[model samples]
Target chain A: SQTIHQWPATLVQPVGSPLSLECTVEGTSNPNLYWYRQAAGRGLQLLFYSVGIGQISSEVPQNLSASRPQDRQFILSSKKLLLSDSGFYLCAYEGADTQYFGPGTRLTVL
Target chain B: AQSVTQPDIHITVSEGASLELRCNYSYGATPYLFWYVQSPGQGLQLLLKYFSGDTLVQGIKGFEAEFKRSQSSFNLRKPSVHWSDAAEYFCAVAPSSGSARQLTFGSGTQLTVLP
Candidate 1:
């Protein structure tokens, strides 16, 4: 079975502060990784996805960006955070026919 | 572009009662449909999915969903509700044949199970 791990289960940051969240996958090789944001009382919005190392695709224009530094490691970063960037951040890897998610990181941008 | 629509914003069901949540999608071709459940402050757990074959698909947590192509709907149902089932439910869709495999999710429906 495959497992996805995300760091800093919860985070609190102020506007204009820099941010970085890491996601790692195990039990799989060269898997597709994705970053999604779920705003309060709203559905998820796709942020970014990576097919392989150094290959990243942005689903929507946003204040965040993603990078696949290693085959199993994906990082979401922001030079300066915004209040609108606050949300539940989810990391997912494409499984056999569907996607499996990580525990997620709850970020509060004050 | 593909999109998912979960009509209900919130629903309240009694424990042991039959439960059903509606979902609809819009796509030009065949789509891969999925339903996921999320507990508060947690990630999403797959409930079931409809890729092809049988219209009725069984999933974890005693939940099932039927795909109605004509109606462009894939509604989720459970024989009986459990208090533990209280959480937000999301419906998603992706192109059957796409390299990106990007899934577009519905707004989601918050399920509130009452005792």
Candidate 2:
């Protein structure tokens, strides 16, 4: 079975600090990866999605960006974090018709 | 652009009672619909989806949703409610023609199960 993993399950960063969140999928190759953010008491918003390595399509204009260096590894990065950047970050991969999600990372910017 | 709407922000249901949550969507063509459940501080879990064939789709955790084309609605329901079922439910939609599988989610409905 395929499984997704995300690093830094919980993070606390100061304002204007750099941010990097990593996501990796095991047991699957060339899978579509996505980054989503959910604010407190709100639904998820799609941020970035990658169909292949070095190819990323941004859904919303934001301070963050995504990169897929390997077939199974995806990274979300930010040069400088903002207070509004604090939220629950989710990593998902497309499987057949549905998408499977990772455990997620909760980042708190103070 | 595709969009989803979950009418209720929060719902309270007594244990063992029947439950129903309303969802509506708008899209240009045939749309792919999905329902996901999220526990506090947890990732969203896919409950059910509607791609084609059946209008009524059965999903995990004993949840079912019916897609009504004329009404432009896909409402989720359960025969009897359980305390464990208390969580936030989200309705999402994606365009069938697009290669991108990104989903547009609604505001979500928070379920509160009464004991």
Candidate 3:
């Protein structure tokens, strides 16, 4: 069975600090990866997605960026974080017709 | 452009009661639909999906949804709600053809199961 993993289950950072969140999928190759942010009690906003290595698509213009270094490794990064950048970050990989999500990382910017 | 609308922002039901959550979408072509559940402060979990074939699809945790083309709706239903069912439910749509399969999600419906 395939499983997805995300690091730093919870993060606290000062505004303008750099940010990096990692996501990896085991037991699957060449899978579609995505990054999404969700505000408290709000819908999810797709930030970026990658179909393959070195290929990333931005769904919305923002302070964050995503990269696919390896086939199943995806990273979400930011040179400088904003107060608005703090939210629950989710990493998902596409299956036949559905997307599976990781445990997620809760980011808090002060 | 594809968009999804989950009309009800919050729904409260008693345990063991039938539950239904409304979802509507707008797309140029046949859309790929999905339902997800998220616990408080957790990632969204895929409950079910509809790609092709049968309009009615069963998903995990005894949940099912029906895709109505004419209505442009994919509503989720459960025969008997459980206390564990209390969570935020999201309806999403994926672009049929795209380099990025990122989904467009609805605002989400918060389900509250009362005892």
Give the per-residue lDDT digits (tens) of candidate 2, residues B10-65.
Answer: 99999999999999998887688999999998888999999999899999989999
Q: What is the lDDT of residue B43 in candidate 2?
A: 89
lDDT of 1 by residue, A65-108 (tens): 89999999999999999999999999999987698899999999
Q: Against the native chain B, what TM-score does each candidate's chain B reach?
A: 0.98, 0.97, 0.97
Question: All models: lDDT?
Answer: 0.93, 0.93, 0.92
The prediction achieving the highest DockQ against the true structure is 1
Q: Please give, for residues B1-115, the per-residue lDDT of candidate 3 as tens digits.
A: 7889999999999999999999999999987899999999788888999998999999999999999999999999999999999999999999767655678899999999999
Clashes of each: 0, 0, 0
Q: Residue A50 in model 1: shift from native, Å?
A: 0.5
Question: If ranked by TM-score, best first, what sequence of candidates would result?
Answer: 1, 2, 3
User: How many angstroms is residue B74 displaced in model 2 relative to the true structure, after the best TM-score fit?
Assistant: 0.7
Give lDDT tens digits, candidate 1, residues B45-95: 999999899999999999999999999999999999999999999999987
Better-scoring candidate (DockQ), 2 or 3: 2
Docking class of 2: medium
lDDT of 3 by residue, A1-110 (tens): 99999998999999999999999999988999989998876569888888899999888898888989999999999999999988999999987857899999999999
Q: lDDT winner among the candidates? A: 1
lDDT of 3 at B17: 100
Per-candidate DockQ vs. reference:
0.77, 0.76, 0.75
Model 3 / residue A88 / CA error / Å:
0.5
